[model samples]
Target chain A: MNPFKTIFGTSAVAAAALVAFGLTAAAPSAQAAEKTSFKLAWSIYVGWMPWGWAADNGIVDKWADKYGIDIEVVQFNDYIESINQYTAGAFDGVTATQMDTLGIPSVGGVDSTALLIGDFSNGNDALILKDGDSVEDVLGRDVHLVELSVSHYLLARALATLGKSERDVTVVNTSDADMIAAYQTDDVTAVVTWNPLVAEILSMPNATKVFDSSDIPGEIIDLTVVNSETLADNPAFGKALAGTWYETMGIMMSDTEAGRAARAAMGKASGTDLAGYDMQIASTKMFFDPAEAAAFGASEDLKTTMESVRTFLFDHGLLGDGAPSADVVGIEFADGTVMGDESNVNLRFTTRYMDMAADGAL
Target chain B: MTRLVNRHPDRPTRLLLAMLPFALLIAAYAIGSDMRLAENPNDKLLPSFTALGDAITRMAFTPDKRTGDYLLWVDTVASLTRIAGGVAIATVFGLLVGVSVGLLPYARATLGGFLSAVAMIPPLAILPILFILFGLGELSKFVLVFAGIGPFIARDIAMRVAELPTEQIVKAQTLGASTWQICTRVVLPQMWPRLMDSVRLSLGAAWLFLIAAEAVASQDGLGYRIFLVRRYLAMDVILPYVAWITLLAFSFDWLLRVLQARLFPWFAPEGASR
Candidate 1:
């Protein structure tokens, strides 16, 4: 018999094949009619490690079970691509820095809400100098970093301490992947980068951390942001995500063997050992307690940090062509405080989920 | 009766025919851009032509506010210099070593397996090693391009050199030509076209290594610019840069083709078996 005979001559076989594929495809949707499923995207970072831990240790599953929903965590090798995926609706939520959350997704016109304020960079990001000790010494020097990224923003903020600006020093746009290698060269005198590259460079001889995110506290905040439309439709998603995060944060910050084991695992995942991961954690001001995060989200300091971020973004032309001023994209904080144009609020820093987590309502 | 095999296109018609595919591609892209824009005016996936034009103008024409450099020209010059340096060094090294290995039995016994082993070691895998050894500078980028494509060029030249008629070498020796004279005078001239053609074939890999190296650790280059704007999802800038790179690569390939034909008119590239 010819192989094409069965395929071309019989509608019966075709119908059976169609039924098989259709049933398989429809099986999940049938079960999901009452229940729900969501995907969360995360990348490697000290603050973002909890997402990995929660997903691996079944904490995410536990919360999803409690809420009668399904949650899957996805990891991306590239940080920006993770956020891009979340913005393009591939994932319901993503781990991102405050500026990146505002710059790419919010400014790109994706309405997103911060489900949880995970942490802020303390000394996680640094401006390292090969020979110098002060930010003033960066004068007439090429500071290598990824251009238009948070590192560039950190450089700007660092230089501002000495009453200088980005123009005072030349920025040699280098990738984070090559940050440690580039610094080994005699030509690269200064570098602005985040951990674990910061940790790697600091371990090297003659590398001095001149300035870091600690100086400008709360500016480089990290959070898990969810699509506004998704969260609005399914409040269970926001609750489960926030609950899972704080629970994982509790374990990560604890002194138990489980906590130590979790850290070790995260260290291994991020291509480091326990001590190196701890070093990164020391520079990261993670919000293990939901109460502290809520307060931070509600504080006037959040608004101030956002203003600087928006201004920096506008200066870099990241606000898109429709934005005439920095005030075009609205940012809404907790307690009814809205920054920028209230008519178009794309990024909302809501403390509601964190408050619920704190009050044990979640 | 003559059919498709016998259909020979005239030179003018062939030139016009090449424009059709490009026209079709442009039309398809325009339609995609229009449909996407109609759905969402702020879509970055497929930007409108006006936005792309503005991005190109900004990059190529306007002096950057901070550095005060014409960015596109600077990037082009920097990338071109690295490629030229890498290819030139590889060419000289390839010719000398390839000629020796092809002609001398001692040279073949010593370097033949070594060359093949080196070629098998993926250049990208050793990129980190290159950075560590040479430091992350232009030299590392150049060496990466060399390591990636140098072996390919060398092996081809060696094969071509080996395939050279034994009669020519015997006749040269019979006419009182020394081994060195036979290599430089007879084999060298015949393989020049082959050398250029191999380099032309290896340009894609050369560009890959150059872009990868630049993307990793350069201040100013086409790759650096594209990656720098990627964080912002600036597809308008990225697509144009990609198009510019393709245009540059195509021009290089075209020039090599023209040069091969002009300089070695008797060499038949069409008869190349591999």
Candidate 2:
């Protein structure tokens, strides 16, 4: 017998045994059978603090037990990459902006549905310019941003507001994390990005917010988008996951000591303290109450937002040639039935779960 | 003398013929770009040619400074700088390790075997550990490139050293030559050709490592550019960078060959077969 092969075989067996032992040791609690696990992907941001909070506290597990399913949340540092990975089938669900849901997964032909309306950028996402320049001054100047992202959409909206076309300025495709560094280097004259990068860049001497997501209001909404197949085959999993989100939100908005502790834990997990986390949550305009989300779900606002996003995605070359209108992106109920007219384009929301939760039916 | 150097009268014609396909491809692409056949609207071809013609014209005349959409040139230069830096470090470290291990048998027995084992380990497997140790900077990239090329060069040179003709060493010893004299005068002279060969081979490996290292936790460089383009689904930017990287790699390989031919002319005789 070859000595090298013998040693290699022994090491492989040892490694396998160690991995098996670790997995068995970490096997979920006795109530694991009552719950089915669902994976959630999120980008690192202050607006996403509730996700960490839910996982750190027993809120996710409690909600799963209530709905008879398991929930697991994974975080990604890059928002676009997380969406892309979700589209590529790495995760069951991902947090994404409305524009990305239309442009990325919907365009890529992956059937996806918005499981939860997370938040909309209020003042968190912005276009910062050097001091002494108005929004009008930005016209015909190069604008740097993560092209085809929510920030890019904000820039386009800003340009339109100034009676300018996209061609009026050069749009450099710079990432949100690198926008601050690029601004510091004097390589770009203007940058559009989201916080905490926006916050960091605003600290520079000449930097000031010339435009922000508030201009577009609900157009830049964020959602927890789930794979259509996962929702269809595992409706219980989807309900459990949504329940976990509501539970986490309850803790976040509560004024109790445990709630504060939960917020602190979430802050630490997300690399921020309680006050800093609160500032981020406020800037994001998050919906912290399940009742509020249920009310929002029944409104015409979300429909209008999805319609505008679908058209924007088409113009940005994200949608495929002669593709079906955005209505087919799977906004269906737990019973796997379509919600409304295919031509409505704006009605990309399923209010069934939210209505049930609000009425104490779940 | 001109006639003697030009013995292969058809060399120029052959070189032109070899470049014809590339030239035609560039022309076709340029014309396609001018005609708006190149999917991207930001296409920049010459003013006279349609979109396709402009693409051909732009392809012929390399863009230096930023023009219409010529910021790609800056990206290309940045990528080339990273590749050059990585290759330079790899060559220096590889040569040092290769020469030291080749000269010392006990060193070869320990360090050479260890390096060979390390060379077999995939770079991706070690990237996370390196990230923790080096903190995602140029130092991490340099370390990965050094590790990747050093072991290969060391082991190759060790094998070459073991294969050195015993007769040469014996002859040197019979002449009352000291160990240092044998190494400097006899061994090094004979080793130069093989060392140069090792460098040529290691350069390709080093270039690969440079790109791979740049792919992880890098804000700038060719690999980062490739990664960012993929995220936005911008295949147009991806293609041009791919072309630039291919051309750069080809140029480096040619440069190394020219250097080898010039520095070690004795390896090929004057009257050798044409």
Best by lDDT: 1
DockQ of every candidate: 0.27, 0.04
Docking level of model 2: incorrect
Candidate 1 wrong stretches, greater than 4 Å:
A1-35, A321-323, B1-39, B269-274
Cα lDDT tens digits for candidate 2, B1-274: 3444444426775576457556644554445334432221322111113433333334335552224344455555656776666667766666667666777777787687788888798876666566556644567677777777767776777677767788988899999999789888877777676776787787777778877776544545766667754665444445656777787777777776677678888875562422
lDDT of each: 0.84, 0.65
Sequence-dependent TM-score of model 1: 0.89
Which candidate leads in DockQ? 1
Candidate 1 residue pairs in clash (backbone atoms < 3 Å) = none
Q: Interface RMSD, candidate 2?
A: 19.2
lDDT of 2 by residue, A1-362 (tens): 43444554566556655544442332212222332666788877666777766776677788778876667788887777787666655577888876777666655545677778777889889988875367887876668777667877888788889788687887765545445555764445688888777777887898978888887787787788876656767778767777777767777779999788877777677676778666666777787765676566556676666566666666654554334644444444333344333432221455555655566665
lDDT of 1 by residue, B18-42 (tens): 5754654565567666655554456
